[model samples]
Target: MSKIDVDSVGQTREGTFKYDWKMSALYNLGIGA
Candidate 1:
């Protein structure tokens, strides 16, 4: 793939992982942990 394509894909993956982490952290907090 082109460099631009690779860069976008990497950025999207990083954003998705960060969002999932934040959601899980909020869930844990809601459960009193």
Candidate 2:
């Protein structure tokens, strides 16, 4: 959960959970794309 890094996570990683989406979104936004 808290230790998760969206960049390292993916869509199909067993128990991916929901935070994955959030982390990915944040990462994309952080890069200003």
* lDDT per residue as tens, model 2, 1-33: 445664446555644655657767898999997
lDDT of 1 by residue, 1-33 (tens): 255455456467777577668768888999999
Pick the TM-score winner: 1
After TM-score superposition, what is the CA distance of residue 21 in candidate 2 from its true location, in Å? 0.4
Query: TM-score of every model?
Result: 0.62, 0.46
Clashes of 1: 0
Backbone N/Cα/C clashes per model: 0, 0
Q: Give the distance in Å from residue 10's predicted Cα in candidate 1 to where it truly belongs.
A: 11
